[model samples]
Target: MTIIVAGVVVLVLGILAQVLGWGAEHHEAAGHAAAAHGAAHEEGSSVLIKRILVSLWHSNLFFLGVSTIGTVFMAINYVAYAGWSVMVKRISEALSAWVIPGGVIMLLVFFIGRHDIFHWTHDGIMDKLVNGKPNPHYDEIIAGKSGFLNLPFYVIRMVSYLVIWGAFSWKLRQLSLQEDLNGGTYWFHKSITASALFLVLYAVTSSMAAWDWVMSVDTHWFSTMFGWYVFASWWVSGIAAIALTAIFLKQAGYLKGLSSNHLHDLGKLMFGFSIFWTYVWFAQFMLIWYANLPEEAVYYNQRLGGFEGRYTGLFYFNIAINFVFPFLGLMTRDAKRQMIIMKIVAIAILCGHWSDFYLMLMPATLRGENGFLIEIGIAAIFLGAFLILFTRRLASASLVPVNHPFLDESIHHTT
Candidate 1:
C-alpha cells in the first residue's frame, strides 16, 4: 500500500509538473510575440511536450533495462550452478517481473513518441536534399542507414525482442514455481536448459536492442562498443539493485538464510562491473577522441561543447558519479561487507547509471533544454512505479527458494 500510494503521488506530481512546464513555455512564447501568440504558443508547447516525452522515454528504458538484466543475473547463476546466490535469486526474479509491463510501456512510447525522440523519423527529412546538395534534413548518412532503420522493420525488431525477452522471463518464473512445488531434479534440468537458451537469445537481442533504442538516437553516429557499454551499465545497476534489496530484506528479517558471504559476492560484482562500465565508456570515448573525425567528434561536441555547451558540466559529472564514487567507495573488503556502506554505494551506482543514460539520451532528444523539476519528477514516477511492482511481486512468493537443489549450500555459504 505504501508503494502504491507513493507511485500514485509521484505519477500525479510528474503529470502536474509536465502541465505546468508546458504552460510556462507557452506563456513565454506568447510574451515574445503578442500578434502571433497562438501560433508561437502552440509551437512552444509542442517542443516542451517532446522534451518531456523524450525524458520519460529514457527513464522508462533505464528502469526497464534494470529489470530485464535482473532476469539475466538469474539465468547466469542457473547455468553456472552457482550456490552462493541461491538464497537471493528470488529477489532477482521478482525484480524481473517489471519487464513485461515495462516492455509494453516502451512499445507504446515508441509508437506515439517516435517523432519526438527520433530525428530520422521526422517528415521531409528522409528525402529532403539541401539546394540540390545533401541538406541536414535529408541526411545522406541517415538515409543510407534507412533500409535498416525504416519504421516497419524497426517496429518489427522491437516487438520481436520484447516477445523473446518476455517469453523467457515468464518461462523461468513458471519453472521456478514448479520446482518449488515438485522439488525434483526434473524441474532443475528444465530450468538449466531454458536458461542456456535464454542466454544465447539475450546476447544477441540485448545488443540489437541497444542499437535500435539508444544508438539510433544519434542516427548518423555508429559505435561497435555501444552494446557492451549499455550491457555493462544495465548489469552493474542490476547487481547494485540486488545488493540493495538483499540488505533491506536482511534487515527486515525476511531473508533468514541469506548471509554476508552472498552479499560479499554481490558487492564484488557491483565493484567489478562498475569498472567494466567505466572501461567501456573510456574505450568508446578514447577511440572517438583519438580519431577526431568530424562525424564522430560531433557527437561529443554536441554533448560537451554544449548543444551549442550547456551540457558541458553533465559530460564530466556523469563520469565522476558513475566511475569515481563506485571506484573509491567500494574498494575495501570491509566496505563491501558493511550493510550501511553497501546500501549507499548501491543507491549511488543506480543514480549514476541513470545520469549516464540521461547524458546519452538528452543531447539527442532535448538538445539544450534542462530542468531539475522535470527530470526529478519524471524519474520519481518511474522509480515509484518500479518499487510498487517489485515489492508486490516480492510479497507474492517466499523470500527464499525453499526446495532448490543447492539450498543447503547457499544457506551455509560463508566467505
Candidate 2:
C-alpha cells in the first residue's frame, strides 16, 4: 500500500509539472530532421498523449524484460545443473509475478500509442508508387520491411511472445513448488526438459521482440547485435534485482542459509555481465560507426549529437552507469560480499538500466522532449506494482527451497 500510494502521488505530481511547466511540445522528435545522402527520415506529429504513452512503453519494456529474464536465469541454472543458486532461485521466481502485468501494459501501450511510438504504424507508410506516382506517405525503406512489420503480424508476435513467456514462468514456478511437495527428481527432470525448450524458443523470440519493440522505433536503423545487447542488459539488471532482494531478505531474517559466498557469486555475475553488455554495446556501436554507411551511421548520429546534442550526454551516461560504475565498484571480491555495497550496487544497476531503456526509445520517439518526473513516476509505479506481486509471491512460498536437490550444496556454496 505504501509503495502504491507513493507512486500515485509521484505520478500525479509529475503529470501536473509536465502540463503546467512544459505545456505542449512539438510532435516531431525535437531535434531530428530528414537524414541526408540516403539516410531515411523518421516523421512525427504533435500528439500530446505521445509523451506519456512513450514513457509507459519504455517502462513496460524494462519491467517486462527483467521479469522474463528472471525466469531465464533460473531456467539456465536448471539446464546447467548449477547448485550455487538454489538459495536465491526463489527471488527469480518472485519476479515472474510481474510478467503478466508487464505484458498487459505492453499491449495497452502499443494499441494506445502505436502511431506515436512507431513511425511505420503510420497509415499508407508502406504503400509504393500509388496511382502511378510516388505516394506522399510512401517510405521505400519501411515498405521493403512491410511483410514482417504489418499490424496483424506485429500484434500476433507480441501476443504470442507474452503467452509463451507467461506459460513458461508459471510452469517453472509450479514445478518448483511441486518439487517441494514430492521431494523427488520427477519435477526436477521435467523442469530441465521444459527449460531447455524455453531457452531454444527464447533465443528466437527475444531477438525478434527486440526488433519489433525497440529497433523499430528508429524505423530505418537496424543492428545485427541488438537482440544480444538488449538481452545482456536485461540479464544483468534482473540478477542485480535478485541479489538485492536476497540481501534484504537475509537482513530481515529470511534465507538464513544464504551466506557471503552466495553474495560473492551474485556479485560476480553482476560484474561479469556488466562487461558482457558493454562488449555487445561496443561491438554494435563501433561496427556501425566504423562502417559509416549513411543509414547505419545516421542511427548513431541521431543519438550522438544529430539531435542538437540532446542525446549525446545520455549515450555516454548509459555506458558509464551500466559499465564503468559496476566495473570500478565491484572489482574487489570483498565488495560483492558486502551486504550494503551489494544493495547499493543493485539499486544503481536497476536505475541505470531504466535509463538505458530510456535512451533506446526516447531519442527516436520523444526526441528528448520527455519529462523525468513522469518517467520516474511510471517507473516507480512499475517497481511498486512488481514488488507488490513479488513480495506476495515471495511470502506465499518458502524462502528456502526445502527439497531442492542442491539445497545442501547451495547452503554450503563457496566462491
Candidate 3:
C-alpha cells in the first residue's frame, strides 16, 4: 500500500505538471518550442496530454511485454514437456497476472491518445488531396501503408491479442491450481494441449503486437526482424524476472530448498537469451548502418544523431549496458549459480531493458523531451501496481506444484 501511494503521488503530480504546461515551458527554455509543437502537430491542443499518454504507454507496454512473456514461458515449458521449471512455475504464472490490467490500460491510452501518439489517425494524413485539393498535411509514406496501418484494423488486432492472451493466462492458472487439488495427470495433460494451441497463436500475435504497439510509433519506418527482435527482448527479460523472483521467494522461505542447480539453469537461459537480444540488436543496426538505405537508414540517423542528439547518448548506452554487462557479469559458470550474483545481474538486465524501451519510444514519440523526473514517476506507478498484483498472485498459489508429475524430478534436479 505504501508503494502504491508513493507511485500514485508521483504519477498524479507528474501528470499535473504536464497538464499545466510546465513541460512545454521547459522545452521552450531549451529552444525546442517549435520542435515541441511539431512533435504534436496533430494533437489539436496542448502537447502535454500526448507526453503523458506516451509515458504511460511506454510504462504499460514495458510491464505488459514482461507479463506476456510469463505466459509464453509457461506455454513453452508445457509444449516441450519440460519438468525442470516446476519449482518456479508459480512465479511465472504470477508474473503473467498483469496482462489483464495492462491490456485494459493499453486500450484506454490508445483511444485517449489516438491523435497524440498515432499521426495516422488524423483526417487527411492518408490523403494526397482532400476533395481533389492538395492537402497540405498529406503524408505519402503513411498513405501508402494505410491498408495495414488503418485505425480500425490496428485497434482490432490490438484488442484481439490482449483478449486471447488474457484468457489463456487466466485459464492456465485455473488449470494449474486445479491440478493441486485433483493431483492427477488430467489437468497436466489439459495444460499441454491448451499450451500447444496458445504457442501457435502467440507465434503470430506476438510479432503482430510488436508491429502494432512499438514499431508503429515510427509509422514511417518498418523492419522485417522487428517482431522477433521484440520477442527476444521479452523472452530474456522474462527469464531474468523468473530467476529474480525465485530468489526473492526462496529468501522469504516461500521456495525453500531451491538449489543452486535450479539457479544454474535459470542463469544459463538468461545468459543465452541476453546474447540473443544482442544478436538481434546488432543484426538490425549493422544491416541498416551498412546498407544505408535512405528510408531504412533514416531510422538510425535520427536516433544516432537526430533529435538534437538527445537520444545519441542512450543509443550507444542501450547496446553496451544491455549486451556488455550481461555477457561479462553472467559469463562464468559459478556466477550463474550464485544467489547474490544472480540477483544483481537480473536487476541490472531488467533496468537495461527498461532503458531499451525508452530508446525505442522516446525518440519517436516525445521528441521535445522532458527530464527524467516525470518518467520516473510514471514508471513507479506501473511498477508498483505490477508488484502488487504479482505478489498477491504468488501468495495465493502453492509455491511448489506438488501434484506436478515432474515435482520429484525438480526436487532432485541437478545442473
**Which candidate comes out best when scored by TM-score?**
3
TM-score of 2: 0.94
The clash count of every prediction, one per candidate, is 2, 0, 0
Indicate the worst ten consecutive residues by lDDT in candidate 1.
Answer: 35-44
The deviation in Å at residue 251 for candidate 2 is 0.7
lDDT of 1 by residue, 147-232 (tens): 99999999999998889888988899888888888897888889899999999999999999999999999887889999999999
lDDT of 2 by residue, 123-204 (tens): 8888776778888778889999999999999999999999989999999999999999989888999999999999999999
lDDT of 3 by residue, 277-305 (tens): 99988899889888888888877876776
lDDT score at residue 282, model 1, on the 0-100 scale: 94
Ranking by TM-score: 3, 2, 1
The lDDT of each candidate is: 0.82, 0.86, 0.84
TM-score of each: 0.90, 0.94, 0.94
**In model 2, where do residues sit more than 4 Å from their true spots?**
23-47, 129-133
